[model samples]
Target: MSVFETGQTVVRRDVHRSGRVWSEQALRVVADTSEVLVAACVHGAEARWPALYAKARDDGDRSVRTEAFEAMAAGEWELAAAVWQETDLLLWKPPATWFSVNAFFVPEGDGRRLRNWYVNFEHPAHRTEAGFDTFDLTVDLVVTPDLTRWEWKDEDDYAHVRRLGIVSDTEPGPWTPPATRCWR
Candidate 1:
């Protein structure tokens, strides 16, 4: 097991099961231990995202995101250069867990304020030389910064990906859907 030092730069790569890179972002390590890796990215951090995902974010068009899911179903998509904007992100990933918890901070008066807590349901982290790799399973949980309200996001995409065989019974681990875990 490789250990990362605080303030060191590392690359987080989202990998498709087909042995292809889906997206990549640069993050700075905040804390590292045998249990979890904590990393963060501030505004203007460089990232590469799926073009259609980028379009959806830029244009606020939901259909573009649907198209991205379709492209993922087909295992073909283009990458676009993007920058982290408007917020600072801190991510906590336990190497053996099926999810990562993220906190997004937006600029407030003189500093930043917690915007929300985002839990991304995904494969457990696979440590790499650069940073770590994981596959996003599409569904996510969004919670208020104060932990009062929470919502599930992208159930439609999760269903779509499951139907397209992007996520199936044979990925890895004893992971189950967030819905099953949280509500049941």
Candidate 2:
């Protein structure tokens, strides 16, 4: 149970890093910690985490937006057939198969590494209000070097959903998919 402060270096807890690292990576590592809800800001951090989904109310930094988008994109049912057709593959390993809009990424070596700040969308579920007309959906952000795969690992890995509270029906892409959950 190690706690990460704002200034500490960030490497995967599952993957260790050397002594020194990038300031952005360090920030991202701490940003990625569940300690802070990089997605919708309802999450807890030693300092503070604002409501990332509170578009009108949320005033969090870049990281918050990125996490929210990833958590929101997983189960878009109405247009699951079409939207799922365009989704990228999962990101994390087993137990944490994350899905969401490409939402862009930060460059890292030959790969596109995401900066912690931009990992979550500034908005929750990253769905445009218009998306609702088409489907009962939940978007998952799938950031990867290659964007040509689709799959699922866990049904409950969408832990961010629990924190996101409720999405407006007025918003496009219905809250839950027509099905239990979607997979392609």
Candidate 3:
């Protein structure tokens, strides 16, 4: 049996900018098996972005790009790239605790093929009666379809959150380190 059945409704609850509980029927399960569960967003899919940042990336405008970088340095997350993401979702379970790879497709402009692959490694999902849910663990990897270059995003954020007692340092599974000998 699959973790979630096809056409099942999945809700994602998050805090909105107004500080209220905002819940949306985010995903509908498409395919499910022991290894992976695929879903698609039911809501209207569009590329949302800050206007200046979108101009920066899409128009090759250096001035806007500089402004966006400055805004990001000032700790604004919403000022990043204009993401035209595909609706399909792939959740892969790799037999590790608090670890799964969520993959998504982002289309590039030329109409050749979808060129961007975004993979997120985060806590293993909890399968609910409706669907499944998982929280992001901060570390993520993005790559091109040709595998020429890849970027590791948010290592500093992970370390900062860990230091602030937000996330645990303990390994997710049963494995532990052996005792170290002190040689002074």
Query: Best-fitting candidate, measured by lDDT?
Result: 1
lDDT of candidates 1 onward, in order: 0.88, 0.27, 0.49
Q: Model 3, 48-160: lDDT tens per residue?
A: 34455567768877577455434433444352323444434444554334654455544446433544455665556565565544544555566666667766655555554
Regions more than 4 Å wrong, model 3: 12-25, 42-97, 107-113, 171-184
Pairs of residues clashing in candidate 1: none
Q: List RMSD in Å for every model shown.
A: 3.0, 18.5, 9.6
RMSD of 2: 18.5
The number of clashing residue pairs in model 2 is 38
Model 2: residues with Cα > 4 Å off, grouped in runs: 1-47, 50-139, 151-165, 174-183
- lDDT string for model 1 (1-184, tens) is 9999999999998999888888999999999998889999999999999999999999999889988988987988999999989889999999888899999999999999999999988888899999999989888888888898877778777877888888886755433445432421
Task: Identify the superior model by lDDT, candidate 1 or candidate 2.
Answer: 1
Q: What is the lDDT of residue 183 in candidate 2?
A: 31
Estimated TM-score per prediction? Answer: 0.90, 0.23, 0.54
